[model samples]
Target: MVYRLLKYVVLGPLLRLLWPTKVTGTENIPAEGGAIIASNHLAVADSFFMPVYVPRRVTFPAKQEYFTTPGLKGRLQKWFFTASGQFPIDRSGASAAQAALDTGVRLLAEGRLLGIYPEGTRSPDGRLYKGKTGVARIALEAQVPVIPVAMIGTDRVNPIGSKMWWPRRLEIRFGEPLDFSRYAGLAGDRFVERSIADEIMYALMELSGQEYVDVYAAKAKEELGEAVPLHGRAGEVGAARAGTAPSRVPESRAG
Candidate 1:
């Protein structure tokens, strides 16, 4: 397929040459069969860097807008996303999130690897945020092991508020897959769901060594001045108060 050709035969070789990435624990990923890669999202480049390093074809859902632009650039962007094996999902609310989770389950059911950032969005300050329960739900539903990935030094490669990529060292550490099979039947129970989610976030925290925020990624984004767009999604702001949202560390602690 186009994705394999682009990655192994074309772009992968070029990116490896240009960035010279160091990928540790490649063996942590199963050589074949299905799996889910739950990574800490730090930078825009996280999307691009992780897939090239994993031998299996890893498909993740990207925002729908990325494929909806206009003109030549739009066409090129669509092509790239298609080649990268990303499908579009509206990042609006529980419905879209559930739909995305369903998509992930379908992929796993068919024996494909699916990548997800349980934080839901990029970490603004590189600290691991509380993971949403969707990740636990998927693992339970699909009966797949979750691979905890720690991405270091990607933020420097393409920092926020910047459009260019700078030459930087990239380190990708893949921790052993975390299994929650013991809680097999409780995946749908809210209490068990939350416990499993917390477990995954803690694993990511231990691997990344970034300050842990007990809040969701989008809320942290708002606090960091990257508020949701005026005409964009509705739940990003007010929904913070809807659920028993996780607590956040003081800014000083995060710094």
Candidate 2:
């Protein structure tokens, strides 16, 4: 309906002419069936380019505020996001994260392509950040494949806090599906979840060529605050390997 209209008749065509993305590895996407496209969140543009290029419609768990805000502008936003296939999930309270995971699992059960940002939010400084384990939980619980996606050079088109987008050559790369069937029944195990999350992040690092930071993007934003610019700053730490989460990260899935 609206999703098709926007992707084909309206927004999609405009994006193609304006940005002209160099997307590759789309063949990696499964021809049919439920899967998770776990991506590195570089900018808001990452959200647009990732789904528009993929063949299937993508459903994402947008923040509740995007739907619940007041005024006419908010109403249009709610309509647009809903029409574009986004659903609202409360990102507050203790169970907030779980709610999102549950929603993702439900979508997967319905055989929809669920797009998730393992880092939870956009990269505050263009470097990959520590990923939350929710993506692992969703993949294992739903028993589906997780494909790692990387959006490159998007920051140049629309940097954080910038009100405008400019035409820039951007690349979107997709890696082969990451199978976690080896740890099938261990979904709730904290170590297994963290291990899986780290593995996905590792794939993004390789595909995106961005440095990896041990800190979460939200925390990094708070810690650095106004002192650091939102884009172009180097990662505070070098690449963190699949099994090498920082001290705060739980132990690996190994016995």
Note each model's CA RMSD in angstroms: 7.2, 3.3
Deviation of model 1 at 218, angstroms: 0.8
Task: Give model 2's clash tally.
Answer: 0
Q: How do the residues 101-183 of candidate 2 rate in per-residue lDDT, one tens digit apiece?
A: 88899999999999999988887778788889889899999999999999998988988778899789989999999888888
- All models: lDDT? 0.80, 0.84
Tens digits of per-residue lDDT, candidate 1, 1-255, equal 899889998988887888978888889998877788999998889988899999888999899988998999998998899789999998878798789989999999999999989998887666667788888899989988989899998888877767898899888889899777776766577866777677777777777776676677787677556543322443343344433334332233221
By TM-score, the best candidate is 2
The residue pairs that clash in candidate 1, if any, are none
Model 2 lDDT on a 0 to 1 scale: 0.84
RMSD of 1: 7.2
